[model samples]
Target: MKKILSITLMMLAFAAGTSAQQLEKLFEKYMEDERFNYVYQKKPGMVERLNDAGSPDLWVFEKSNASLGRRMLTLNGGEKSLEESFTREVETALKADKYEQVSIVRNGKNRVETYEKITDQGIAKVNFIKNPGNIMVTLNLYAQKK
Candidate 1:
């Protein structure tokens, strides 16, 4: 049992490294979009590992090692109508044709949405959070997707 657990951890670490690389491209792509200005990103390892043995705050994307990146973005809500429009635009993009809706959880008025898409590059996992203060997105890569 110990051997099995260790091997699994090794595999996760390897995939996490690959995920770190692929998600960087996705991050750069989002940077091109004009809607977001206040952006904060922490590469895979920069943030602490997602709790595995312990309970997860949100459900996993599909399998273990599927989520590996974190990004926080803010919209310019200078005008109420503009903020609503931006929010709608982002939500629509998240549900684009290629992406599969993984899961969604609600905490009071806040909404968290997770989506994944498998491409030649890898599996892209994007998470969107709609809260009063700002919108946060945490993008992950599942490089070894079956």
Candidate 2:
């Protein structure tokens, strides 16, 4: 009975690992998508010193309601092209991941787009915005394991 239980536990672990791996690959694909790369060329974690060398524009933070917490490292600003192409890329990535377009608001030159995906782990949300001068992107993963 003990041996059987051990095997079951191992299988469960493997299944969880596979799910995580698939999630990661999807993220990488989203990043590598030509539409995304064409607009924001900088890779994640490449700090930039811009206009008078202000604080690093890129930042990420994560918090959980438990003894375990996660860290979110995000990229803030980068090269920007036509707003039309960038928005298309955003929609493509989100839709491919099965995230429903939650909302999109436009206030003149500024616009915000939100997408949410329901997964076994929890809700995965992504926010994308474009202003007259720069674009902002953030990813939020809730109830995720590891």
Candidate 3:
């Protein structure tokens, strides 16, 4: 019984590690591509300040501490095939991370999908926005307020 428990724990740890890596690998693969624009903010506290200032997006960041910073990757003016490929990769990464789709909103040609995953360190949220010819993926991590 002890051995079984140890193995199970190990498997969970490995899953968590791999899930975190999948999204990072996807970001690395496209960050330098000329067709994509990558933005990474090292200031997780910035979100906290925004929350303090009473931003409308507070509903999502409520009772949270963004300790893991934020990253955004945008693909603009790409071919249909490229856009589709990126979308597929993002979907795969989110799935691998065990992220749950919390909400989806669509207005005309613009659509936004939000996914969230709770981790040991915090909650990770992803905002994926799709427009007529552009796709943007943003990752945010937040620790629950104690």
Candidate 4:
């Protein structure tokens, strides 16, 4: 019985890790879907620098350190079935990843939520925005500023 419990625990831990990585897989899976729009940045520094130089007040990433990279996936004007399915998948991944919900803002038909997960290197932030006909998920990775 003890051995069985130990194996079960290990399996659960492995599943959690895999689910966390599913978020990235989710992005890759839908990136080329005609129903979605995708944007990826290898180095988000240029945009961060521009934001810092232009509007210091709006540059909040500094609080996390420096921007290492960013990826955004947008689902726009899709069928109700597809939208529902995508939403479910995103929610499942977030829950499995154990990301802490940092903030949520609701304005009329639009809702924006932020989640953060701490890593050894730094922090990973996700911004999820949903409107009546649109859903956007943005993942931002930050590294410790040297």
Candidate 5:
């Protein structure tokens, strides 16, 4: 009986690990680009910075809710609001009939929020986790360009 119990426990652990791995794989397929240099999460804000090699003055920062699933894209030195950029991107993409299958959801129990951008660029996804203290956050960035 003890041996059987031990075997069951081992199987359960393996299954959990496999699930986590699958989640990570899915997330990877949804990130923006590989050129992003800095990704940091602070209180109430999560920032992802990317540099445009062709135009040094053009810097993009994706800022989103550290807790909720709301997100916005901003030009670092530009006068435009991040929210406006976010809206414009969505509108343009929709008008061009680019992204039609994208979806987003928040899992309260796991404290994880996922965003899946399904387009010709492939699926770009992000996962955010809130730690026990509710003060620290872990963000998994995944984007497939082309």
Candidate 6:
């Protein structure tokens, strides 16, 4: 009886640990995908175009090594407010049909926000805004590999 009880407890502990790890992994994947999509859609090519036009603008997001980490990219430009431009660009990309159940939020201290398409893999959260001399963008993506 004692051996059986000990074995049962050990199995339960292992199961609990596995579940916790899985949850953490899921959160990390979600954040990574969210950030990657935001950068891929917004920065890279667009910044060069803005620069060539003699615009004081460039943007990039630096991601963390870990999943579910805080990632931020900033855009630099001389405009009084890049808010409208940022919104339009994001809206256009989202409308292009890459993601579903998309949502956008404005008027928050953080500025523009949107949800990436939910996939069988996971979820993604993206935020963008014009702050001081730069436009700041952030992404939180969650994906789980089957």
Residue ranges of candidate 4 with Cα displaced over 4 Å: 1-6, 52-60
Model 4: per-residue Cα lDDT at residue 59: 58
CA-lDDT, candidates in order = 0.60, 0.52, 0.83, 0.84, 0.36, 0.46
Error of 1 at 34 (Å): 11
Worst 10 residues of 3 by lDDT: 59-68
Q: Which portions of model 1 show Cα errors greater than 4 Å? A: 1-42, 51-70, 76-78
Model 4 TM-score, all chains together = 0.83
Number of the top-ranking candidate, with lDDT as the measure: 4
For residues 57-116, what per-residue lDDT tens digits would candidate 4 score against the true structure?
535556537778889999999888888889888888788777889999999989999999
Which regions of candidate 3 are displaced past 4 Å?
Answer: 1-16, 44-63
Ranking by lDDT: 4, 3, 1, 2, 6, 5
List the RMSD of every prediction in angstroms: 13.6, 10.2, 3.8, 2.6, 18.1, 15.4
Clashes of each: 0, 0, 0, 0, 9, 12
User: Which pairs, if any, clash in model 5?
Assistant: 30-123, 30-124, 30-125, 30-142, 30-143, 31-124, 31-142, 31-143, 32-143
Off by over 4 Å in 6: 1-71, 80-86, 97-110, 130-133
Tens-digit lDDT track of model 2 for 94-120: 555667778899999888877767767
Estimate the TM-score of every prediction: 0.54, 0.45, 0.78, 0.83, 0.26, 0.36
Q: Give the TM-score of candidate 2.
A: 0.45
Residue range 12-122, candidate 5, lDDT tens digits: 888765654443332243235332122333323323243212334322223221122223222233333533443344344333432233333446533444344443333
Q: Which ten residues in a row have the lowest lDDT in candidate 4?
A: 52-61
Q: What would the per-residue lDDT of candidate 6 be over residues 16-96, giving only the tens digit for each residue?
A: 656533322432443454322223332324343344335233111212111233344455553554545544555554444
Note the residue pairs that clash in candidate 1.
none
Clashing pairs in model 3? none
